[model samples]
Target chain A: MRTLVDGQPGTVVPVDDRAFLYGESLFETVAFRDRQAPLWSRHMARLDLGCRSLGFQPPRPEQLLAECRKVLPESGPAIARITITGGSGGRGYWPAPDAPERRVIQCRDWPGEIDRQRSAGLRLTISKSRLESGPVGEGLKHGNRLVQVMAARECARSGHDEAVLLDQAGSIVEAISSNILLVVDDQLMTHPRPVVSGVGLGWLIDQPGLDLRLRPVAGEDLARCSEVLVINSVSGVRPAIAIEQYRFRPGPTCRHLQSLWNEQLI
Target chain B: MRTLVDGQPGTVVPVDDRAFLYGESLFETVAFRDRQAPLWSRHMARLDLGCRSLGFQPPRPEQLLAECRKVLPESGPAIARITITGGSGGRGYWPAPDAPERRVIQCRDWPGEIDRQRSAGLRLTISKSRLESGPVGEGLKHGNRLVQVMAARECARSGHDEAVLLDQAGSIVEAISSNILLVVDDQLMTHPRPVVSGVGLGWLIDQPGLDLRLRPVAGEDLARCSEVLVINSVSGVRPAIAIEQYRFRPGPTCRHLQSLWNEQLI
Candidate 1:
């Protein structure tokens, strides 16, 4: 990966950084096309809200963009990860409030399969690894992602493209790396609890004609939905081929969202 | 802090390391006295269990010890932290199963006030930040410690020595960095759910005469306990003087445990 730690071209960060030590940090993954990140503002807004929630002095968006620009490829498509962490700290969980937050910006080659998988429809499996709700910074895209890591591992071993995580109450929370959207009762909806406010999902729901609703999705509801889709900043929008035994064809709504996504970013 | 990355003297790790990227790691904090780590074996045992649970090939205890010794102080008291992480990976949560794990060992000067505080007792306050239960790898001392960080911040800001965390059901889980033991109904007990399975607490309960029972401790039960204590490898054992409005004096059992700890380590 091409990486920068605090704007310098490097791939290492101080081991004592609280993010490395305790996972006390926030991050955003953006997809850049021809050096332009269409969802950059939404990603930054989420990061800023996360900083305030976690009590870190928010870094200016312009400053973060400058660092990201340093590592972002000048042409074609790429993936940019912006990580903000409280720098090195003494041996404890208590962070020094005045410590300057550090940023690690990394750029990676866009996954070549994303475009092919978008229309092909990705496979999704329900994972035994559940997302714990009510942890501090619940909806924020923070660094404490072991749950997702484990789920993703399960997906890889099971030969599925992604894993859908449920909550303790058997409610569908999200996929390991994306948010869930489904057409139930012919209404477009997403879960209201314990999920990252996905940048791509946010953009999709905010489009001029989409009437989006928030509802708790039970695990059993997967089989009932006519169409299921997973959305994220990196993957944009993807139709799901199957969620366990429940198979979903790319329905009209799914194709419409994909077209909207392509029109904006492709 | 004196440090070593995989037995080599360094304070930085690759930014792509899953430990830094996704909090996909296990860690143990040990207190070393005169270059001796009394709880080293227990810590290693916990780390081994964690590695197995997380599907990482566990590093040999001897190798980890050699790395710790490289950074441990030649004499006097110090704190040693051993972190094991799945090394650098690509742009997703699915860890490469064959990737070699990395270890970071760090040693720090022991807090000078620990000896004074052992007998003086620590003040504990209930925190608004609750620990989420049922996340995969629940009881492992993993790198995802944001919940504790937020609780510790609450303690530091509230002028208390530690903060007590409760699970979603309002049951007492543990203090910010330690496990809780209490004398309720004149029987020594500890909560059985969603805690780190503290090494120091294990040693104490294993002593010849102490009978330890596992029970779920409700938040309302603090006031009914005869005495309350917190235990961890780094802190050894400490009497807690208060849990919010509930006051606890160092009772006979607490003093006996303290004497046993000193006799074995000091």
Candidate 2:
């Protein structure tokens, strides 16, 4: 993977990048095909929402697309990472009177190899952890990610591939990194938005004939679901077969959504 | 300001610094005095605690001390920053299996002199903003500081010097970066635990004849306090005169604490 700054071969961030000092940054991961990135528009919109939340000016779309063009992987499947920070010289915590630098980075290939699970599904465990979010930071994905890190660590130590974090309101929010979708009878059910609002899953839920409902989902409700699926930019849609003791077999919804996910990319 | 990496003047940091990626780092802002840092031990302990909480190994005390001596500022006050990230590479969220790279930075001196209010005190407006913390991250002072940044911006726009952010429980936790101490009915009380376990103010509250109680302080209870003081390494202990409409004069307790703080520094 190569790194670039403003469409160059090399770049190092300033010492005072707000993302380094205060986590005053936003990031998005997109999937790449050949040397091109799919879902580029969706990723840009999310990154812009994050920038708007931080009150930082985002870079021009043409510039961003140009940079992405230069650094996207030339071969194989890769992950594109774009990060923007409230750049150098912020007077301690507040944004300075002057404009700050904007940063963009695109790296090739997610270091993680998940093809095995993509074909065979993954085992998920319920997380005791909960996500705390409100209007201030609910929809936007800024760099304040320690809680996500905590949940991820918990998942690693608990011998599971991922964790299903709940919210303060005793409802399942989402997996630590992806959105959660459970097939309930003939309908699709996911937790309401008191927790994180997953960007990818939001679109999937909007697809017609899905019969999606936003309701408070508890652990008990999982036993009643026909199947469960998780979605993310890199992982796309994959079946979740086991949530701790509760088990599930791949069902029609999981297979259908997976096909739709692939179709959308094309 | 002198920038050093691996004990020499260096401008480039290895992309592998955990602090750069996951914010798997901790830092301290030591008050520089004539080429010496007075609160070095306390600052170092907090750094060690941060590493401990996040499960990162810390630098040897002698190694850190030597680095501090090597990079002490030439003149004026400075903010000493040391960020340690769980370095090395892996696809998953688990910490890399290696001794992490540590980043040490010492700002020669804070740009643009401190506001004149360090001694005269500044008006504070209790913010509707709140901190994101709980049992896991309560007082580690790890790199997840976007909450503080958000509160600082709120202070700037609202025409206040600083903000007192509430916790998830709606209990007054702290004033963005400092510990909040209140003189209530001739008693000094502070919120306990997850609000903030600030090192400097925690030491001050331990002095004799100090009726320091760690309790959940509601917004209403705080606005009625006799005198409110915010404490940190830079500010020391400055008595807050008013919060919104509630007013406070320089009470005896405030003066006493100020003297004690001065004596301790001397």
Candidate 3:
């Protein structure tokens, strides 16, 4: 992977960085094709929202784009991840008033098998760990993601491709990393809270031609779905073939959305 | 400040570290005096508990102690902070199964005025941000501390020395960085849950001669308290002069505990 710290090539960040000590950071993952991150605007929008929620100045989109372009490969599928931290501060949780924001952009080769997972579908397990709600940056892709990390670890341990997370009330929240979509009665339904939704899902919802409804999803509601799909910027859309014991075939809605998502890559 | 990363002198950590990426880390701050960190054992106990909760191997206490000794000043009051991260990992929350643990030990000059604050007392304000419960590592000093960061920011903005936090149910949790104690009817009381209590408070409770009771404390209960104190490894014990509109006086109980805490420094 190639990395740029504050637009300069480097991999190390100061230990006193608030992100390092207190998880005071936000990140966005953008998929790059032919050296351009097509979803850059959507990622930046979410990053800007995150900065606003955390009370930090958002980095200029053009500068972030330039940094992403610098690290991305010239002509292949890659993932560009941008991390913005509250920068280095003294030994405490209170951020220095003048602390500069540190941005790290890293480009890595996209997993080739993600395409296969996208087409063939993934086996999903219901995670034992649940995401906690009521935090200030609930839906934002902020750095304090220990819950997701633990859930992903469970997925890996259970040999499932992904883990489905629920909120404290046992309502479906999202997948470990992606936003979840359910085709219930041939209508696309998703949870509406932007605070908890990912940028990729936000983009998917805004795209033309899909009839989408936003509402809370209960576990029983997921069982009633005709199809289940996970969406993220890096993988676009991936069908979930199985969640626990319930099995799903990639329905027409899943295929249509996948096609819609893939169209942007070209 | 002087730092030792993985037992070597350094100030920067890899950006890809799980701690940096996902707040997959734990830390303990030990107060050092006369070239010895008297609270090292207590810190290690909490660190080990955190590791157990997070499913990582705890570092050997002797090695951590040796490293702490290296960074601490030869003879003076200082603070030694030990941070253990899940080390460097690939571009995802799922940590590499074999990822090595990274330990960072940092030594800094102790705040000279904390002693005065302990004696004269601190002005405390009730924080607007509330701590969420039900996370796996709730009480552990794991690195995912955005809530504390936000509360501390509020304290700084309100011009208060500290902010008192409440759980989702409006029960007292702790201050931004320290555990709270209330002398109710001349009996010391604190919340019992390990998930919300600080290591400093844990040590205080274990100290001989102080009668400490563990129970949930409501905001209304603070109004009935004879005295209120906050304890952390860095400052030992500090009296809280106020919490919102409720005022407190540093009673004899506060003085006795402070003396018990200071006795260890000698």
Candidate 4:
């Protein structure tokens, strides 16, 4: 992988960096095709909001875009991750007001199996661990993600492709790494709260042709859904084949959405 | 400060270390004096429990102790922090089963004003940011400490010595970096739930001479308190002079406890 730290080439981060020390950081994983990130603006919006919430100076969008462009593959599909840390500081939780921000841009090969998973559908399971809504930085993708890490570990342990997470109220929040959408009686239904919001889901929701509505989704609501889908920036869209004992066939709606995402966005 | 990573000298951590990537790690801040950590065993117990909860193999206590010893000053007061990360791994939240645990032992100068703070008492305020008890790892000192970080930020912004946090149920949880105790109606009360358990509080509770009792402490209960104190491994015991508009004097109980702590433990 090609990596840059604050636009300089490096692989080592300071031990006292706030991101490493106190998890004071934000990141965006953008999928790049032909040297262009489709949802760069949306990713920047979220990153900027996260930076402000975490009390760090947001990086300029042009500079971030330039750094991402520098790391993107010459002409192939690649995933570029931009991590902006609150920067190195003293051995304490209270961040220095003037601490400089550290930005890391790294480009790696896109997951080769994304297409296969999108076409054949993914196997998913419900996670026993529930997401706790904090007073701040709830929807934004900040670095403190042990809950998601634990949920992903559960998915791996259960031998499933992904895991669905619920909030403390047992309301369906999102997938471990992506946002979830369900089709019930031909209406697209998703959880109203963007708890663990996904950049890909934001982009997909803006698409003109999709029938999308936000509603509180419970386990019973999921059971009534005809199709289940997950979306993230790196993996544009994938259908869930099974959630526990319920199995779903790859549907035409998902295929059409994937095609639209690739043709117009990618 | 002196530093070691996995028992070797190091000042840099890998960018992809799970601790840095997803906050998938646990840590302990231990107080050391005269070449000894007073609450070493208690810290190790908590760390081990956290490791188990996070699905990482716990480090041998003997090895961790030895590392801490290596960084301690020959014969002075110091603070040693033991950070056990899930180590480096491939680009995902689900940690590799064989991922090596990374232990970082760093010794730094003990806060010089701790004694002064203890004698004069601390100015504390209730934090607006409430701690959400998670389904798992609620009491563990995991690396995902954004909640505490935000609380500390609140304290800094409000110009208070520390912030007392409450859980979702409006029960007092802990201070930003320590556990809290209140004396109400001549009865020593602390929150029953170890929401943010501290090694110092655990040690103090086990001491035979203390009149500590665990009960759910509410906001109204705090108003009826005669004395409030915060305890942490680094800052043995310090009285809270004020919480919002409520004023508290440096009571004899806190002074007596401090004397006992210094004489018997520290």
lDDT of 1 at A118: 86
- Candidate 2 residue lDDT tens string, B1-266: 36666567665554434455556566777676665666777788888877777777777867766676667766666666666655556453455545555666655465343435545676888777766655256688777677777778888888887788887667777897788888777777887764456777866866788778887688778656888888887667777777888887767777788788778863
Interface residue Cα RMSD of candidate 3 after superposition: 1.1
Error of 4 at B40 (Å): 0.8
TM-score, cand. 1: 0.97
Tens-digit lDDT track of model 4 for B93-183: 7788788888888887888779899899899889989877776688889887888788887788899988888888888878888889888
Candidate 1 lDDT, B150-234, residue by residue in tens: 8887788898988888887888888888898888889888888746778887787678967888887889988789999888877
Q: Which residue runs does candidate 3 get wrong by more than 4 Å?
A: B194-196
Q: How do the residues A143-221 of candidate 3 rate in per-residue lDDT, one tens digit apiece?
A: 9988888888878989998988887777777898888998888788887763356777878778887789998788778
Candidate 2 residue lDDT tens string, A142-257: 66666666677778777788888777666677887788888777778887773445667766766787778987688778888888888877788778889988888888887788
Candidate 2's C-alpha runs over 4 A off are A110-112, A194-196, B14-16, B74-76, B92-94, B108-115
Candidate scoring better on DockQ of 1 and 3: 1
**TM-scores, all models, native as reference:** 0.97, 0.93, 0.96, 0.97
Pairs of colliding residues, candidate 2:
none
Instruction: State in Å the error of residue B8, model 4.
Output: 1.5
iRMS, model 2 (angstroms): 2.6
| Chain B TM-scores across candidates | 0.95, 0.90, 0.94, 0.96
Question: In DockQ, how does model 4 score against the reference complex?
Answer: 0.77
